[model samples]
Target: MRLKILGFTTLMALLAACGGGNGGTNPPPASNTLSGTVRLGNKASSAQIASSGRLLTSDQEEFVPGEVIVRFKPSLSVQSVSSLSVGGVSLQRVRALGLESTGLYRASTDTAGTLRLVQGLRARGDVLWAQPNFIQRALKTPNDEFYPYQWHYPAINLPQAWDIEDGTSSPVTVAVVDTGVLVQHPDFAGKLLPGYDFITDPRQSNDGDGRDANADDPGDEPGGDSSYHGSHVAGTIAAATNNGTGTAGISWGAKIVPVRVLGVGGGTLADIADGMLWAAGVSVAGIPANPNPAQILNMSLGGKGRCADSPAYQDVINQLLAKGIIVVVAAGNSNEDAANFRPASCSGVITVGATEFQNARARYSNFGPRIDLMAPGGDVQADLNNDNFADGVLSEHRNDAKNDYDYVFYNGTSMAAPHVAGVIALMKSKKPALTGAEALDILRRTAHPLDGTACTGQGPDSHPGSDCGAGLIDAFAALQALDGGGGTNPNPDFTLSLSPNSLVIPPGSSANTTLTVTRSGGFSDSLSLSLKGAPNGVTGSLNPSGNSATLTLNVAASVKPGSYALTLEAAGGGKTKTASLSLAVGTSAAKPTLEGAYVIACFYLGNDCDQIKSRIIQVKGQTSGPYSFGDLAAGDYLLFGWKDLDGDKDVSAGDYLGAYVENGQIALVRPSKSGLNFALEEVQGTGMLLDQVQHALRSLRSR
Candidate 1:
């Protein structure tokens, strides 16, 4: 009566940095880069645009031609400084920065003598700031030996994803619902959470008992050959990364919850179904609730029957989907239509096929409308990396003796499924609340089309060539899709933030922060938390409490000393917001560095809340220098350093000792601000705004 579910190995860019030296038209030199704030006088009017190209906003709003943001001293009006001419230049205000109304303004001028105009403005008595906008680059290279050969990472544009995020800041839990993982594997150290064995039949449960809580693999050997399927799959999803050891995982910061649903002779559909539910933290009859439910579920095992014949499995998939857990499955390796497979053919699961390094579908991979996309599944016969090693997917496996951890090459729809699963984990790590439907959509929409144009055909169904799903899954493009093009959300519904926004730690030390996600504009759906951009030797952990999470950052003694940009994101209800922080390692009090800060203000525009700008500040102990906020949209605003002094992400009464604020709310006429140098003051009042900030800070402390 048990339907045995067998394992199926399913078959399957850096932009130039701004440089200087060439000419006004020549690209900036790759090495000579600049980083500073640009300030304007009046908000640039439409007619004030230069004679050449009119000002246009790039994604960062810093690429507008003939314009730089302007910040005026507190209590100063745009009109007061509007008449102060520099050379033949004139100034006009565009808008405020975020919600701030008075201090900051976007200014425009004729393109001629642009550099000279900036110099002239800086010297003026009325203008407080003028500088060129600086460009930042993403980390493109990892020093790992096999990284260059990981055509999979670059093929999917993971370097670009790395620029945006790495899994370190907000670690997401991914359930590897397969044979069982090698808990003692070095690559999986500290990465495995408590898991359960769902195999009810003692005969197939090779570990001696039936339906136990131990999820460690005892080595699945059907005919004297141990298949380290789970270990390999788990490694692909979260192998110890950037450790100068083995290959890196797509989402290296993710944690794996190994739920053993299959054993020696494989497992039945019933056990697999229960395992899937349990992986999502759903209650099973006799098993304890999974304390660390997975945000993403990877199922590389399936039956060879159409989903229509497996109502039970299909229902579990739907339930997992409804719970906001992304389900990723392998397209059956039978070289037939995936619609003939159990979980792969089921609705609501992302069915992935295998692709070789040549971008062609693997010879044994299934193909059909049901297949969602493809990923590097490796082809053992070829050495695509040309390193003299087989191109099979390299991951943590077992030695022939089955007693120690080793590396092995594997290829199948089973292998391809984990790549997609790992990518989904990466997406979830960046936007934790991404729904199953949304995850599926992003995979399909952002996949590199493998329409058989790039290489010769392969796969059993390959006639004209390879005919798989959309194409190779692109990690970078998929992550970009999560940002919804990195502009204003037309339906601004939720607001999320991380306290402390910046921190400093010594080598071998650790730090902590808090993240808060608040529903707004009528948002009610649940949201998920994720962290991105931690450097090597640093790991981020998230313990969630309702809409808030406490994030802890741990650094290894050997972590290289440098400043890292980190992001905290919350995604749900089909929308997302990201807050950033700066972590400087091996830094000292005497050598302080101004990481970054933010200010909130209200406006008269579309939403009552105008803009939230990242305010630039000096290092903690700096005595005096003008702080500037550029390209601010017009509105009334309040400023708070929001320094999580204790790293608790809260504004306690004692923590407010050095609170900084302007005399009162400033009304901005343009998108820049300067002067009105404010000093730290003791708590002056306890109003609704203060209460709100305190309330947000307390969310992280609540649990």
Candidate 2:
């Protein structure tokens, strides 16, 4: 029931699309009114009427309670629409729009029966739409001048999303678990919520106490300087935005619940784990329940370790997931795969990597399968945007010598995680019921894959490289997906290639390949190149970091003969694209290949269709009758072959797409199912997207 601008063009589009023609002479189709929410033609004017004399304070109200705006059928007069009565209650027309003759009116009812009457009006044949006069919030953009330099917000498309919802109405709390926050910073002024200090060791808490409720920063610097790390992170997520102050925050309307977990010398695992649960609303023995539990938790800290090794931390994450609270953690800043980090590697959390201003993975940002996505953590070296400012993220900081608050730019995965945390705030503000898994999926599905390139190999000796996550977090795109839309930047609309698609070499020998990128679609941006995947005992390197480069693959003398597949990604101008490379160490003749036009894999039994994973192959254009899919693990699986017609990469009803059915299931204990074959058949969309998919897999038993 958000009060939006509802443009004239949009109204016409809705009328035309919903079968309402002749200037609302006909009622909108039932399908259009299924949601039973109020619809308004002029949202801005309506908001002005509602907020004319309302009190403006920190505890500001978003919408008028116990009231709804109703638009009667065009045939009905304004007087007639307002004269309506329900259940012995008379509706009052407090305001009207569209010349006094039209039927739009803002009506009032007692709070006791507001919900019931609103629903009843929506069902009336005389009513066109009945919507609650939802409290409208001002666009949540901050007026801090330095906000222009904070390029991270635009990189993730935050501004576009702010127009839809500023996250003010929903009381979504984001718990920042870090060193501590400078509560007096101007940017964080009335936004701080009551938080707790979890540092049990008095020496580390630096407050001369242990486990207290005061969550203030005591400055974690060794030389008595303020670390400001926690404060910086907090500002990124919920600084006092749009107040014409310092810097704008992402979710300016959401509350900041600061939980001090890390301290002067770094925090212990036990303290961190306990703080996480407490922030999530779980009561720790002897401690009071957190009255304001967070819907989103931001942990911008991590250490080296496979998450599976920590049973205590993993259990807490599961608990938070069940509570519908999303946990976002930073990938370690060690420039290694995030899979080796503790909570970043933990399941049920979204792990974020860092990206430079140029949209390439930040040199220090960790990556790998565990990494969910990337955000601007900042890179000071290259001025891709030529803004004359370092690309590092900017936030509130305490200048020790001045003994006052200031701003500073810092880089790390720690900085990257909060960007995601803030975006989650926006998502939860729009849809409060989103579960942790749903948040991750929405992020992944809407993410702009590394400008169009996949993260690959390291760069040079002086300039280290990074393998990024899915891509940059496009906040606007995510909201669009939540609203049933898709990606907007179709850039990287170019081609990627290797001079030699395949290479052959022997032990102690080397091979050279040329990586090239061909730009198209008016794309003239310089591209950054990266490589990934060299077989065991073989290493690959790209000479330079641009559109075209030479790749050198050095094979160790101890390496065995085999074939390997490698990936190359190119990023630039807010776009990323990728191409695959193949290398042969000695011989690939011994490798087993699957025979199929298209391949489908169903794993993790229960005979679950939900777990069904499929791949479409090109057979009609291939000169060979049979194709081989390499190296699948041993398991009981169901395989299918299909001719993809719609090119959506999935089987759907609208297209002539068909899949193989008979004798598709196989037991690949070893080389047993090598020669299996099947044909394709037409199927409906329901078969591809229905309950069968969800029924295929069951949850893994936690220890």
Candidate 3:
């Protein structure tokens, strides 16, 4: 649980809203406009308006938000109403306001209205934004995202990469140790076995009066709030796919065991330690015995501290590994060296880092000697499609209140860690007898070297030494490496060399070089030549395939000049040999003019919603239509705007926002004339209110 200082005004307002009113002033029946936030012990609900001048008691069977209405009349002259009854069913009374004698209280058959009323009472009128839970939706593709299951000359494209292989009947169980899982999610419905909640705060672990399992604390948030993070993580590992709904996950066939350890903000090392033990099937005091033991444990959370090889933490991790369970942890997102984080940097567990779809290290990923493998964490800046702008995954977060079902795009090592875990599950499913070391070897050996860099102890380009273990993980290559024959060296000895050794080339210009190879151990066939290093906006290629290959490199006129190295490799006899050459490139003084409009579309909380016309901004000096700029230096830039498109002061989701540079250079297109059009999309739903309550309650206490 986390705690925050509630300002005096906010605190007074809450007290007055809940306690100041004396019974009988007979406040007018709460108005249909009656909207407020309700604090349940430590947890708070989203702000909602009473629909049809009525509210539903918590126990009503059909009260859905925006669908139902029920009203309560406090006893006259009563200090406060403590309870109320509806349809013969009694519920704890909520602080009532907005009563008018002439206003007739009417009840609607709609349950959504009642839910809205309850939400209003919980939020106290302040509505926060909401987004969809992405993690819950993305966990459908278990192996395809991490491992290539079959081998083909060029790799065959299948309708769905994640299809269950025949003859695989066994199912594996993996424990998700973080926030609690949404066992109720359609993807995980029946698959979520009973689990334990070790959160010390009673208010947060209570589980919202849902099903009774081994144990339940209100949750990490003091008042029974659930951390969507855990659910997101769990979804990444075992969300069912092909259900014709949301995103896909990695392990569609696997079962998830939710072990709630960190709550609200986070949990202590001790609680995490306990959670680990329980997750690994180890018997512990005070916890109900796990009826179903987990073979793999997915821990997507960690702290920044040197790995303390202390007997306590080590013993717990070691025991799990000894039992044949592979533990996966995230390489922290601090962007600092990974050596600073504990457990992740600790031995006995697989430490994973983030990479973009292109297999490049994520700009924010932590790098160090300890990182074992890299997986697709998606780049916020890289154009996922060739559309020319960065696009990636967007999921639900615990931030928004009003549209709690909405989701946003977030990039971090946290997203990368689970990809590795899901891949492990696929390997386990393929070869159930594979040991942890064997599985690690399969994953590491198959990784594609980033930019032709050697996979020895030395790191790839940009990252020298052991920073990026092996290189970028290649699902296709790893599966091929498992086939055995590829392991044999194709070429024994054939060295290729490049000239200019090192020289600068201007952008948009080509540099030609000759490759000379000396044959020794064997005769070389046509050599398959490839160029590995060049900065973004620069392109390089090898000409003439054979023992003697020619090299041609082009640096985009907009390329940012920088020092780089490329490796030229020769192959024959099932073996490969490589030689490196260095070069420097300078960017062009000219920038490509950019003028385009993008149709902004988005789905929030599983709903299609639009608020675009209000948010689009026109660049200064540029007309409302398409426009462009001339030459500009290579550097970072941003676009900014805020409902100001219409000169409005408030910045709402559909409100126009301008862009401003956060980091990096905009060289591919004209920086000066380049302009980005904004299209805003927002998700809608009430589920976000649940997230807010959890966050608030968690903020009120310490775990």
TM-score of each: 0.48, 0.50, 0.44
Q: State the displacement of the C-alpha of residue 97, model 2, in Å, after optimal TM-score superposition.
A: 59
lDDT of 3 by residue, 1-703 (tens): 0113233344334333332121111232222111111110111111220011111121212111222111222223212435433332233422221121001112332443333333332222121111000011111111111112111101111113233321124567888887776554555555577787765444434444322343322334453223466665665666665565544456666777887765545654445666787777776554666788887887777655455422234556887888888988877665657776656777878887766555566666677768877665555554555644343333323332342332334455666676677666766765678677776776766554343232221123255424655555544444444455232222234456654344445567776667777543124355665666555776667767444566777777676666567666666556677767655554456321112211111111111112211111112222233222212122222222222221222221111222221111111111222234432111011122223222232232221
Q: Write the per-residue lDDT of candidate 2 for residues 1-703, one digit (tens) a residue.
A: 1111123343234323322111112222332111011111111111122221111111221223455556666677666545667544567764343222222233454432454455445546675455443221110111111798899999889999898777786857999888778988889888998898877668877888888888898876546665667888899999999998788899978898888877766675556656778888887754677888998999887665566534446766887888878899898777777787768888888999888776777777777757778887876555667777667788888888778888877777788899999998988888888877777767766677763233532232232222454567888888887787774434325567775555555678777767877543235677777777766788877886565789888888888865567888888888788777666565323321222223333332322322222111223322123433333333334333333333343333222212222212122111223344433332221232112221221111010
**Worst ten in a row by lDDT for model 1:** 6-15
The lDDT of model 3 is: 0.45
lDDT string, candidate 1, 55-95, tens digits: 11112212224444444555675545443355544655532
Can you tell me which runs of candidate 1 are displaced by over 4 Å? 1-149, 222-224, 453-456, 463-466, 486-703
Score residue 640 of candidate 3 by CA lDDT.
Answer: 20
User: How displaced is residue 344 in candidate 1, in Å?
Assistant: 0.8
Off by over 4 Å in 2: 1-145, 381-383, 451-467, 487-703
